[model samples]
Target: MNDFKQELIRYPAARITEVAKALSGDLRVRILETLGDMPMGVSQLAEALGVAQPTMTINIQILEQAGLVVSSPGANREKICYVTCKSILLELPVKTGDGLHRIEQIHMPIGMYSRSIVRPTCGMAGHDGVLIGSIDDPRAFYMPERTDASLLWFSGAGCLEYLFANPIPPGVPLDELRLTAELCSEAPSFDMNRQSDISLYMNDMPVGTWRSPGDFGDRKGKLTPDRWFSGTEYGALTEWKVTKDGGYVNGIRATGTTLGDLSLDYSEPIRVRLEVGKEAEFQGGLNLLGSGFGDHPQDIVMSFVRSIDRQ
Candidate 1:
């Protein structure tokens, strides 16, 4: 039990549609059911299920790419398949829209940060109530098990980036993009005097930087676990929105970067990074709080807004 692991795979609703396709066929489901017990070679699986090996291989490939299963070569070099995670969670929006709905939202876990360069006082906590690794160790931040983190915090200069999968269908131009999160300044245990300038970036382009008032320790966060005490607890639920007008944080104009400035209609995923660099004016560091450790109930939420007023 000393070795930590994550057995949950979460997907956005839009992307879930793609994954749902893999599970649509009965043959694929059967293959999955069989793989759940143990890993098997493609030929062995097909024979046991009384299906053609060629047909089985096709279905298995789809699940392998969706991260539902892992396939490898065996002694005879035949492909072996094994289910990856114990469970899969698909996050669906509360509402669906085709005409009136102009926004698409996706939540990215704090631990799923694709890139980072954190310094001392940095650490992460999994939902299980155990710290992933020793604090202040940048190497620990790269642990594969960090995906289970409910909260990721750090002191000093560093940046955490997430490659957000755009939900805006191809060929559709976006008029606005908004990112919302719960964050506060990092203090030794807890200090109201600490202030930090947190910057937001999209695909290496600077969106804006806002000054956090102080490290929050006012009271225990509603979702904070018993293991955490006297540390930064909660944060202001702020929204950084970039629209055709400009970039606005909490309804206050923070950056003039317009919607057109980002050219987000690309094939690659959207890159969003939150940073508090070493050279920052107020380098109080950052406490990027996620659900179960913050006042908020969710992690980083991104929404794509398409305005019909213009299009």
Candidate 2:
């Protein structure tokens, strides 16, 4: 087993190419994709794909050689094959800006909070009081150009803000502003119909608002980490925005300043804020997974762009 693991892990680029060439069959990609989600026996895979067991085994061997799949002994000593690769992070050969057009990517782990409470959620705030973290914790502190964040908490009626010090160059028209965060319910108990109303503000004006649903509080979510996803809970990747016309969510035009109603003036500092509150009759609280939600938190990504035509 050790030799097998080492051989798979320490393969040189030339060896990898040789293995790829060996497995370059038409049905190999489909077989790998099917096995990527879970492990399965050869008989089961062959039956599902309407192929003979021997034929399936031949393809599996090719995939295993390519280091794209792994096989092990299963129940009753049957052979089980599974995919080991998670994702493909590739760097494209493209030219960007010299200095000012640099793009920075940062990753922040969540689930590191020891203690969190409501009424003051975690968020990013600028030196000039622009909030960016969560809505309830409007006074959260943040630094400029930093992407990953570990915010604390937020309540029913509060806001979190983040400020970007990189001033918008004068005479440059702001092209777009976007904000995204993973949200879940913080309650110990589950409640259906639990909702958290969030709003985005720019320079103290309403930009957009999104109503997020809390988990059933019964079990953890599917995509969350093991420690966090084990319980009966639910959350989602929520985003909203403001445009020249109005606010929108997932592309649908939303009425009111739900986030799409405001615009940024690149000629000055960019201020972003998040507001959390209860709808007229809904009841729920939010657990914001910033840089401190779980064992593997997410770095909140915020972008402020200025168009060349606007300049």
lDDT of 2 by residue, 256-301 (tens): 5532334444455445565564442433455555534432245445
Off by over 4 Å in 2: 1-99, 102-117, 120-152, 216-234, 255-269, 278-283, 291-297, 308-311
Listed per model in order, the count of residue pairs whose N, CA or C atoms clash below 3 Å is: 0, 53
- TM-scores, in order shown? 0.67, 0.46
Clashing pairs in model 1, backbone N/Cα/C closer than 3 A: none
lDDT by residue for model 1 (60-160), tens:
88987777878766878888778877778987754443322467788888899988888878888876557888877888999998888887778867899
lDDT of 2 at 259: 29
- Each prediction's whole-model lDDT (CA): 0.80, 0.51
Supply the TM-score for candidate 2.
Answer: 0.46
Pick by TM-score: which candidate is best? 1
